[model samples]
Target: MSMLGVAAVIGVTIATFTTCGVGLAHGTGTWCALPLVWFIGFPLAITNALIVGLPLAFLFCKLRLTRWWQFAVTGFICATPVWMELAEPFTSVRWAQFGLYDSLNCFGSGLAGGLAYWWISQKVGIRRGTDEIAP
Candidate 1:
């Protein structure tokens, strides 16, 4: 639980920075957008962490599928639906109209977030009963 919270914070921070970086690249108001991005991204990231990530984590544990690549793939898969909803690809007449840049942003964030969570969990050693597994 605490791990999830920490991972969420890290994920949100990465996302906020990514957003600001993109804005800066476009010569937009990057600093002015920082607060808004953090405020909005934090809650959503946390919610996604709980609603989607938690169950997947448990399932991975149960199946002994704790590889780093597996987590990265899971993160990418989880982010896809969220991106679709945000981009409203279904609502658009041309699916190609969906912004590839935004998709990449979300996917990258998710991948980083998953890797962060996996690294934290490994470092902290997931507790199963009295045995600690660091795999």
Candidate 2:
């Protein structure tokens, strides 16, 4: 696999660990939920990659949207209520139970996730075709 791809996986894994770890701590779950968090994280990450990450990728590729503010705003908007709303039905959770803060938490998490990805991509370099741009 490409180094960029590997870095994405590693970066997302770390982000998931920290985000979910803290989320479970604050949410209506226990340490016993850790396994489930990990279980849910990877798939949810794929959902985020598709639902949130894709547009960002498009902007990055087509529009060359590389600004930090662009990433943060785009990531927050896509990942906050939108990702949750879209992905919720696929998950077992009832939408009625979610409050405003849940979205805020998701926004924060998505913001961090995007930053994590950007930082990792910067460190590992971004791939465009078979060649990569060195950091």
Candidate 3:
């Protein structure tokens, strides 16, 4: 990779960390939840991006359906399982009433993440397969 590519990566990494850190701080319970947000949260972000985000993007790119709406709906479906399955036990404060709101939260978050990936890929000049190597 070129020096400019390395610099761009460093900048994006810092920006992502700062964005996520500030978001975590503003969401209440900065005391106890902050640590979990860093440890569990960052890992989950990496996991979702790699596991779910990469494949989804590949499918979209392969199918030539890289529209924003495609990203949103694909993201929503990919993330629905995490919210419905993994996040259920934590909604104890108002368990019965939390699903409606948290469901949206989870889906929106996924959509945003997908859009971010697409935007970043555009900004960074990445293309998959043949276009990635061809002039």
Off by over 4 Å in 2: 1-32, 81-101, 127-135
**Candidate 1 residue-wise lDDT, 1-135, digit = tens:** 667667766865776577657756877433534565467656766677788999998897877676788877887787776677777745564335425445665776677778788889888875433355556
Q: Kindly indicate the candidate among 1 and 3 with the higher TM-score.
A: 1
Measured by lDDT, the strongest candidate is 1
Q: Estimate, for each residue in 37-102, the C-alpha lDDT of model 3 and write its tens digit.
A: 446545554565566666666676667665556655675566666666646776376445444444
Number of backbone collisions per candidate = 0, 0, 0
Candidate 1 wrongly placed segments (more than 4 Å): 26-32, 89-98, 127-135
Q: Ten consecutive residues with minimal summed lDDT in candidate 1?
A: 93-102
lDDT of 2 at 22: 62
Tens digits of per-residue lDDT, candidate 2, 1-135, equal 232233334434554566556656779442333465446544565566675576567667565556556666665665655455644664445444444334444565566656665666666655434354456
User: Which residue segments of model 3 deviate by more than 4 Å?
Assistant: 1-35, 89-94, 126-135
Query: Sorted by TM-score, highest first, which candidate order results?
Result: 1, 3, 2
Top candidate (TM-score): 1
Clashing pairs in 3: none
TM-score to true structure, per model = 0.73, 0.54, 0.58
